[model samples]
Target chain A: DVKVTQSSRYLVKRTGEKVFLECVQDMDHENMFWYRQDPGLGLRLIYFSYDVKMKEKGDIPEGYSVSREKKERFSLILESASTNQTSMYLCASSFSGANQPQHFGDGTRLSIL
Target chain B: DQQVKQNSPSLSVQEGRISILNCDYTNSMFDYFLWYKKYPAEGPTFLISISSIKDKNEDGRFTVFLNKSAKHLSLHIVPSQPGDSAVYFCAAIRQGAQKLVFGQGTRLTINP
Candidate 1:
């Protein structure tokens, strides 16, 4: 079984603080993704990394950036946390194939005050 | 504009009955479709998927039906159980594309 693990299950941060969300996958997949799940918006992609040091912006990448220094770990950085940015964060990893299914980690529910 | 849409916000189904969740997409270029199931506080799990070459795919109690002509797809859960209740998200991607577009999910409740 594939396992994708997130650094935190729940988080709280003050406005204007910097936040980091970490994810690690054991399956050695080549693709990693960061997504924010909202009530009406569902899962909106924030950033994705195809390989080490290679990242791409997704639909909702504003105020967020990503780091993929290693194949097994991907990190999402919130430049300046705000109340509106509070939401559930999900990390997923998939194989290189186009039609392959993505395996997800248990999400981190971040609350910004 | 939202490329994928799931108009129904919620659905209630009796246990042992069938539950049908529908999804529609406006992007004609999307050639692959997938369904994901998510529990509260958990990330969405890959439930099932169907490529454009085929119209239907089935796995045990879950079946995914696709209609390319209408750019619509549906997921059917048979003998719905209480454990089957969750938020279902439909996603699509164009062939060879690195990104997948997701729809606003539909929450399904299975009543015991």
Candidate 2:
């Protein structure tokens, strides 16, 4: 079985604070993704990394950045947290293929005050 | 524009009955479609998938039907149990594309 782990299950931060969400995968997959899920909006992609040191912006990447210094770890950074950024963040990983199923970690519910 | 759409926001069904969830897409370029089930506070889990070339795919208790002409798809869960209660998301991907476009999702509740 593939395991994806998120560093935090829940987080709270004040406005204008920098926030970091960490994710690690044990399956050695080459693709990793960050998504934010909101009520009535479902899940929207924030960013994705295809390899170490490689990153690509997804649909909604504003106010967010990503780091992929290593293969097993991917981090999502919020330049300055805002109340609008509060959402359930999810991390997923999958093999390098067109239709490969992605394995996800338990989401981190973020609250920006 | 939202490429994938799940118009129904919620559905309720009695246990041991069939539950049908619907999804539609506007983009004809999408060649692959997937269904994911998510529990509260948990990320979406890959449930089943079907390719554009095929109209139907089935697994134990779960079946996915695709209609290319209508650009619509449906997921049927037979004998839905309490454990099957969750939010179901429909996602699509173009040929050779890595990114998946997801729908708004439909929440399904099963009554015991």
Candidate 3:
């Protein structure tokens, strides 16, 4: 089975602080994505990396950034944490194809104070 | 512009009864669609999928139907069990695209 691991299951941070969420995939997939789940908003993509050092902005990319320095690791960075940024963040990985389904991690519930 | 939409916010059904979840898309470029089931505090897992070329696909107790002309799809679960209760999200990917656009999702509850 494909396993996507998120570094944090839950996190709390104060406003204006920088927060990082890490994700690693064991399946060696070529695509990685970050998304935030909000009530009545579903899962909105923040950023996605199709290859190492390559990134693309998704629908909601403001207030966030991503890094994919290596093939297996992807990181999401919050420029400055805010209360509105508090959400369940999900990391997913998949192969380079239109038919492949992306495998997701358990998600990190971040609370900004 | 919410390209993908799940009109129903929630659905309730009795145990051993059939559960039908609906989804609609406004994008004509989308050629593939998928359904995912998510539990609280966990991630959404892939459930079933259907291609725009095919109208229906079935697996065990789950079935997916696609209506290309209407840009609509539905997931049918036969004899739903209590464990089947979860949030169902419908997602779509445009032709040759790797990114998927998701709907707001519908919460499913199975009552005994």
Candidate 4:
């Protein structure tokens, strides 16, 4: 079984603070992705990394960035957390194929005040 | 513009009955479709998937049906149990795109 682990399960941040969400996968998957879930707006991709040091912006990339310094680790950064950024953040990892199933970690529910 | 759509926001079904969830996509480039089940405060989990070339795929109690002409897909879960209740999301991906387009999920409630 693939194990994807997020650093935190719930987070609280103040406005303008830089927030970091960490994710690590044990399956040695080549692809890592970050997404946010909102009511009525399913899961929207924020960023994705196909290779180490290579990243691509997803549909909604504003105010967020990602780092994949290692193949097994991916990190999502909030430049300056705002109230609007509060949502359930999820991290997923998959083998290097479009058809491969992506395994997800338990999400981190973020709250910005 | 939303490329993927789930017209129904929620569905209720009696336990042991068949639960069918529908999804539609506007992108012809999509070559694969998948269904994910999510619970509160947890990330979505892979449930079932079907290739665009094939019309149907089944796994245990979950079956996924795809219609290429209509650009639509559906997931049927027979003998639905209380544990089957969750938010179901339909997603699509084009060959080599690596990006999955997801539709607004439909919440499934199984009533005894």
Question: What are the candidates' C-alpha RMSDs?
Answer: 0.7, 0.6, 0.5, 0.7
Docking class of 1: high
TM-score of chain A of each: 0.98, 0.99, 0.98, 0.98
Encode model 4's per-residue lDDT on A1-113: one tens digit a residue: 88999999999999999999999999989999999999999899999999999999999999999999999999999999999999999999999865988889999999999
A82 Cα displacement, candidate 3 (Å): 1.0
Candidate 2 segments whose C-alpha is farther than 4 A from its true place: none
Candidate 3 residue A13 Cα shift, in angstroms, is 0.2
Model 4: lDDT of residue B42: 82
TM-score of each: 0.98, 0.99, 0.99, 0.99
DockQ of 4: 0.82
* Candidate 2 chain B: 10-residue stretch with minimal lDDT: B93-102
What's the C-alpha lDDT at position A69 in model 3?
Answer: 99
Ranking by DockQ: 3, 2, 1, 4
Q: Top model by DockQ, which number?
A: 3
What C-alpha lDDT do the candidate models reach, one value each?
0.95, 0.97, 0.96, 0.95
Alpha carbon lDDT at A12, candidate 2: 96
Q: How good is model 1 by TM-score?
A: 0.98
Which should have the higher DockQ, number 1 or number 4? 1
Which lDDT tens digits does candidate 2 get at residues A28-52? 9999999999989988999999999
- Candidate no. 2 TM-score: 0.99
